[model samples]
Target chain A: MKILIFIFLFLIGPLTFGQEALNIIFQPKFETENLVINKTYLFKTDTLKINSFKCYITNLKYYKNDSLVHVSRKRAHLIDATDSSTYYISEHKFFRFDELRFNIGVDSLTNVSGVYEGDLDPSKGMYWTWQSGYINFKLDGTSSRCPGRKNKFYWHIGGYLPPFNTLRKVSLKLNKSHPRQIYIQLNKLFEEIDVSEVYNVMSPSDKAIRISNKLQLLFKQVP
Target chain B: MKKTKLLFTLSIFALLSFDIIKNTYFFNPPQYFPQPTYDFQKNPLDSNKIELGRLLFYDPLLSANNSVSCASCHSPFNAFAHTDHDLSHGIFDSIGNRNAPALFNLAWQKSFMWDGAVNHLDMQALAPITHPSEMGSTINDVIEKLNASEEYKTLFFIAFQDSIINTSKILKSLSQFQLTLVSASAKYDQVMLGKDVFSDQEKNGHQLFKKNCAICHTEPLFSNFKFETNALPVDPSLNDLGRYSITQNPEDKNKFKVPSLRNLSYTYPYMHDGRFATLKEAIDHYTSNIENSDRLSPALKLPIKLTSNEKVDLIAFLLTLNDKEFVFNKKHQFKKISIETKE
Candidate 1:
């Protein structure tokens, strides 16, 4: 009889446990040492890690706002991170008001489905072909001052689909302010990225772990 | 150790019982059809998932600007095919190059789309969702939209036991709803089962179909469902080369999916381009201007000489293939949720 009770409890236990849900707000930011929109930057260090940086923000509101509208019931919009061309500071619509959110690598899911359009669309180039998963977030551009080439650097970070599934969720708390904005430093993320092999991540490899850890550090509280 | 062993054995037994009961209770294939081509072992059927897919199919949120839906073209009243249009129209009033085919009995289909671009039903929605001129949205966008809806969350939880909607769940649910569109209760099916006999005119039409059309239309399901070019002239304006666009093989230029003859009474203006609006016009094209092309089916080496009386008989036989019950079934219609006006 005891064995039967144990079996029943074990069978039903996992299903009964409710998951913890949290309300998270993302902010975006951009900084420059010798900044120009079209030009690239380079670092002398062999490795670069954007450990603690900020995701800046503007025109943000809770419940609702004019320019910063939430997608009905959902709280997300395409930052149009494709390029600064369509989403540059001078687009005149205050388009550079960045809001950062990420799935980054993988979440806990068993099966993968096919072609998703939107922020997850292939037009964004955030999809993985080898294992079939979305990268959730991508931070890629050229860094010229880096030691790799005369003026060349790359940061392609994403992986999700077992064994190498490396997406992480983050939470941020902010004090009472009209708008929320935060910064993420590239110091640690650049440091953690592999310099031994030019530290490029194409698929789910050791590179996924390096980039995932570096990305998690970017999410911190706003005072 | 003994307690652990006993618990493990009981859990396994319960799992086995659940599988057996669910498989037996949920699924019921028609008596006459062969084993479905879809491997159900990969994705199990669920009542809730089917319900969720039905909701999504009719929801405009699946489009780029939330303007179009799967039902925009493949309406329930039209047997899942668009009516009164030769080519399917999409977002911003953009015209797609091909007609929207009727969607049903997908479990038996080995491939999807008129061109067979996607090999599995699981991967089929990706084509229309991203086809620019079609739904003009991506599966990811659709998932995000679904995730936002409280009603969809409830629907998703009911279907997959969790409200965390993803691409897999969305695709599987859509597949479930489409897979259930089995049109097996037509008058032709009744005649086959000896429940009803065809009228003398229908019987004559049946014999004629067997002679000229049966080699392609086949029997029972009324489709061989193979790619065959039935010698059609190219429309200069559209310049669309059916299956060749996907395969890029010269041999496949004019070929298209040989559509099922079932539901012909409802699925009018046939062919990939929907050029012919009536069955008589379609039959006449086949008999008259069967343009000789390299990819034309060997069966059409010579023109099919069908007299006017024979055309009437052939159409008579085709009309009996309509499955009205499958069309008006409330299970596949729009959800009763009041459309929320955009703020």
Candidate 2:
């Protein structure tokens, strides 16, 4: 009887005390097509090969007309374009929300804090080892349009300092009629950024702060 | 009634567990020292964990080529700062950009690196382990090597009951060992604690130090740890702009983290670029050689003036900051692992 009760509580605990995974899905796309490694696509009459794209999505929260509703505290979701399994956000209980918000990078508190496991781990390639901060957005690819050696470009954007604090909060409004989906449009980013002149952005700087703004616009409520 | 009884039992168990952890290892600083900034509750100190960290500190497996260890640059004998080379050397005889600073009293430090680039002590090792001219290895690669090593598996199990090695475990273990390096047993500390008295020359030197250098190199820790301009001209060869490289702020140009003055004798070849070789040269640079710059510390716009005799007196007081007991401690030295190895 005791064993049965323990099992029952374990099953129902999350549902009773929030933090149960939501049905919403995060989809990564390039214009109309799905993003996948080993796939080459045309970017302004040049073949562009996306080697990798990963980002940190943190501080997921929901609100209804400015009233506090739900918050997924002390957790950061590491999203990788190559890994389709990482696209899901383990969300809290959601009855209804008018405003959906999340941060594009790790918070300053978590960045200054010590080692973490799983998604926030230093081994994840998302955290910059040379400097202390999580790489909020990482995108590396090679394109014929890029003038660098082998036509490669890498952008690792992160900083916790002022004037270059790359952590950006993304806010999107939710309509009750729309499907529970968030689309991360990579094409919108490529459309604005010049590939040849702006190749490398490895550290936190004025350029990183600008690129971080462009990354913020990538996420949108979809379907 | 049953729930109350269960809660009472759990509270008792939690108290006992807390007692065991507290008794395992206690990091006690001198009474005058400030509380350590490191959150001990998160990564509690255990003797086994600290021992594992000490072994890892000396292990060359942290390097990509396995030829250079952390001790290659940060030797235990030299107050954990290399005395052989001014600039740090890494695998394949690669040279690093800046001088390897001494590592002691790290728990009280707010940030790591000369530029204050690294914010936490646990994350500080990652910079060297992955820097191209340093160990030239990744956290994942080092962890893979540790997981494959038979000896590490046993040691890790002893440290943290689980044998599976990960990044957090490795970093926390390293931090646990470094946090134990508290340099508060110097003669200066003894004098402060009413156990000893300073000589007349040393006493005069201490007073002079308080007047001239004490603003930045505060007593107790002997460093404010804030990024400040020492007005040393940038070395043209390296073209290192110090904190400006990290912050990109023009005001922060030619600035470096104020290093602690504790254990100065063992950690010589002083300054950020290791330009000054001896105590006299470093002191001379401060007194007469300070170049005027807009970003210079307001107090140092006019270089300090000191007679040759007063300089000698100040040097005597500075020598008292050297913690001989810490440098010679057997516990901080490298150990020959007695665990059976498969390799």
True contacts kept of each: 0.07, 0.90
DockQ-based CAPRI category assigned to the predicted complex of candidate 2: high
Which parts of model 1 have CA positions greater than 4 angstroms off? A1-223, B1-27, B337-343
- CA lDDT of every candidate: 0.64, 0.85
Tens digit per residue, CA lDDT, model 1, B138-220: 76688788778866775665556676877767877888778777887889888878899999999999999999988888787
Q: Listing candidates in order, what is each one's chain A TM-score?
A: 0.53, 0.87
Q: What is the TM-score of candidate 1?
A: 0.60
**Worst 10-residue lDDT window, candidate 1 chain B:** B15-24
B75 Cα displacement, candidate 1 (Å):
0.7
Worst 10 residues of 1 chain A by lDDT: A87-96
For model 2, how does the per-residue alpha-carbon lDDT over A74-156 read when each residue is reduced to its tens digit? 48889898789888765545556777788999989999988999889988898888788899998899888899998999888
Best by lDDT: 2
Output the chain A TM-score of model 2. Answer: 0.87
